[model samples]
Target: MDIKFSGVTKIFEPDIIALEDIYLQVDKGEFVYLVGETGSGKTTLMRCITREVVPTRGQISVGGNLLRKINRFDLALFRRDIGVVFQSFLLLPNLTAFENVAFVLEVMGLPPKEISERVSEVLKLVGIWRRRNLYPPQLSGGEQQRLAIARAIVNGPSLLIADEPTGNLDTHTADEIMQLILGINAAGTTVLMATHNQYLVDTYRHRVVEIHRGRVVRDEEQGRYELNGGC
Candidate 1:
């Protein structure tokens, strides 16, 4: 799932410019890290890709489809090809882990049997199969996050976007989640992760795109976590 942004700018009400003249591209099967400080347009950039918010100016293309031209109906269809995991682990407290993951496939109108199979597969892939019956409140922070990742990938999406997916966990658990994300990417899913963890960014040594004050500061192949330097 290739993503391209050309001269993109997003301005909120009054005078807030969330992004400015942004140009970026991520090829298929690439694991790209989007790193920045709080409110530095990292989340805004992800929102643009997901179409949660439209850019005030410029164009974005995902998997060859222009975002500006996609109608609401077509946009809904386009979103199914992309998966998103968030820092908050937005799982339903009333639903079991299996049910939460299966809900995505259910919304897509898949057959019950197929939904069950796919949900089971992804839960196991994320190492949470044994806890499928647990509810969100019953699971630990790491377990809940794993469940979130399972839900995100249950549809076999071509692209996966993660926004601070490890922000709530301890170092050990964060490392585990990072490993799972890497494994998912290894299985051919294009990954774009937004995070502030410098250690993970430096250790992984993947392509990094750094943003600051609504502008791209650095983009590097096998990049480290450098805020004050350019690649």
Candidate 2:
């Protein structure tokens, strides 16, 4: 769904400012790219949306739910509507591919049958079903990433937040993963992806929000990674 950040500011202890007066709005079903240097506020902004880091000041809302006001009891429910994919493929090494995705539904307390159906559906969707019996360490980087994406989207979240998801992959593998992410966005899932890959950013030609030093420097529609640049 839609995300709105109004005058949001976040400061860590000992006077470390992670975000400052950040005001942004992402419409539902839009795919937006977050581009910035390392240590920029992109990750912090994503974390704020997920309530992993509460805003030190101002307000943030996702689908009309005020983040700062959400209580512990409702936080889990709120997070169910969002999916996160990290740069490192954070798959369970011990669990098989199917079990890794199944674990998410299990924790949500879904019935065994329903979990089996949903897990199967997503594993196939990510093209990892044939490798369902494989453990994380047994899969290639691309295969592991596919499994990670499958696990993230198994719950059918409305919002997908990815942080450098293709960073650790080769060009061809990264392109494959990017296409899968684009397909998810095409299916009307709101996407916020943080990346340093200029080729993908420019080629995709989606909305670009550039952050620098904990502040938004630019926001553009159908924007390239850099001005006067194209893939």
lDDT, candidate 1, 163-220, per-residue tens:
9999978988899999999998998999999998888998888999999988999988
Model 2, 70-165: lDDT tens digits are: 999899999988999977878889999999999989989999999999999988888889999999999998898898899889999999999898
TM-score of 2: 0.96
Give all TM-scores, in the order shown: 0.97, 0.96
Report the error of model 2 at residue 47, Å: 0.7
| lDDT to native, each model | 0.92, 0.91
Worst 10 residues of 2 by lDDT: 222-231
Model 1 local distance difference test score: 0.92
List the candidate 2 regions with Cα displacement exceeding 4 Å.
Answer: 227-231
